[model samples]
Target: MPGMVALRYNPILKTFGERLLASGHAPKAVIGATMRKLVHMIYGIVRTGVPFRADFCSQKLDFQDGI
Candidate 1:
């Protein structure tokens, strides 16, 4: 699951939703967006042959050359 955050109004969600709309996403597209993120996370684990670790963290440049 994503990092924890308290429920509160945030302009980013509106902005993101607007972008999704512009890209032809329907009102229920949030589910798809979330699923896509999950798929990416799973793909990352498989691509690197690594199991998920709670403390896992890396910068994009860190693996530019492939570990």
Candidate 2:
């Protein structure tokens, strides 16, 4: 449910979802990947003891493969 909300409302994930769809990926696969991405992001924040920041997250996404 959180992943679905992120997919709809979060700009970074929204863009990533669009790209995946455009590349012929299945919708379910895209959602699964987005969910994984959200988990990774959450892990990073917890590990760093920092709050979530959209700008910082998007910048990190820039260097990621296929994003």
Candidate 3:
């Protein structure tokens, strides 16, 4: 399902899920969070009229101190 795909390929969700697992979160909780994330992503794409772009989706944000 989409949850499986997100776990395998969606970088943001994949990393988030892994971190939650490492922190001792339940597997079902992780999967549910990932599914919610996927839904939000789909909604954003639909609202913006932009095709799903894996490259864009996988980009990591760089945070600088003192914003």
For all candidates in order, the CA lDDT equals: 0.45, 0.83, 0.74
lDDT by residue for model 1 (12-47), tens: 333333455566766456445544545676799899
Question: Runs in model 1 with CA error above 4 Å?
Answer: 1-27, 55-67
User: Which residue pairs in candidate 1 collide?
Assistant: none
lDDT of 2: 0.83
**Model 1 backbone overlap count:** 0
Model 1 scores what on Cα lDDT?
0.45
Which candidate should be chosen as best, given lDDT against the real structure?
A: 2
Lowest-sum lDDT 10-residue window in model 1 = 1-10
Question: What is the lDDT, from 0 to 100, of the residue 20 in candidate 3?
Answer: 71
Tens digits of per-residue lDDT for model 3, 1-67: 7887898887777876787787788898888877987898899999999898766734452221111
Over 1-67, each residue of candidate 2 has an lDDT whose tens digit, in order, gives 8778889998989888888888899988899889998898889989999988777667666566673
Q: Which ten residues in a row have the lowest lDDT in candidate 3?
A: 58-67
What's the lDDT for residue 6 in model 2?
A: 84
Q: What is the lDDT of residue 11 in candidate 1?
A: 33
* Alpha carbon lDDT at 25, candidate 1: 65
